[model samples]
Target: MKFIAEIDVMPLKEILDPQGKAVKLGLGNLGIQSVEDVRVGRHIQLHLEAADEASAKSIVEEACKQLLVNRIVESYTYYLAEFVLSN
Candidate 1:
C-alpha cells in the first residue's frame, strides 16, 4: 500500500525564532501591525510504501525521531493516510 505523510516541524515555544521575529518586524514595517506574534516552521510531505496504516505511521514516526525533528529546540507532528490517485 502507498501512504502519504504530512509533517510539520516547529521550534519549541521556549526557543527564540529569529526568522519569525524578522518576518513579524517586516510585516509591521509594511503597516501590518495587527499580527502580535509569528512563528516560522517547516512542512514536509513524503510518499512511501507500507504494509498497513500502522506500519506507515511507524515509519513516519521513526523518520521524525531520527531526522525530521530536532528534539533539542524543535518538535514535530505528522498525519498519515493512504494515497489515492485522482482521475
Candidate 2:
C-alpha cells in the first residue's frame, strides 16, 4: 500500500521564533498589527510504500522522531493516509 505523510515541525512555545517575530514586526509596519503569537515551522510531504496503513503510520512516526524533528527544542505532527489514485 502507498501512503502520504504530511508533517509539520515547530519550535516549542517557550522558545523564541526570530523569523516569526521579524514577520510580525514587518506586518505591523504594513499596518497589520492585530496578529499575535505568530510562529514559523517546516512542512514536509512524503510518499511511502508500506504493507498497511498502520505500518505506514508507524514508520512515519518513527522517522519523524528519529530524523525529521529535534525532539528537544521542536515538536512534530504528522498524518498518514492511504494514497488514492484516480484514473
Best by TM-score: 1
Listed per model in order, the count of residue pairs whose N, CA or C atoms clash below 3 Å is 0, 0
Candidate 1 is scored at a TM of 0.94
Model 2 ranges with Cα > 4 A deviation: none
Clashes of 1: 0
Instruction: Report lDDT per candidate.
Output: 0.95, 0.90
Considering every candidate listed, which one attains the maximal lDDT?
Answer: 1
Q: Supply candidate 1's per-residue lDDT for 58.
A: 93
Models 1 onward score TM values of 0.94, 0.91
Candidate 1 C-alpha lDDT tens digits along 1-87: 999999999999999999999999999999999999999999999999999999999999999999899999998988888998887
Clashing pairs in 1: none
Where model 1 places Cα greater than 4 Å from the true spot, the runs are none
Could you tell me the lDDT of residue 69 within candidate 1?
Answer: 92
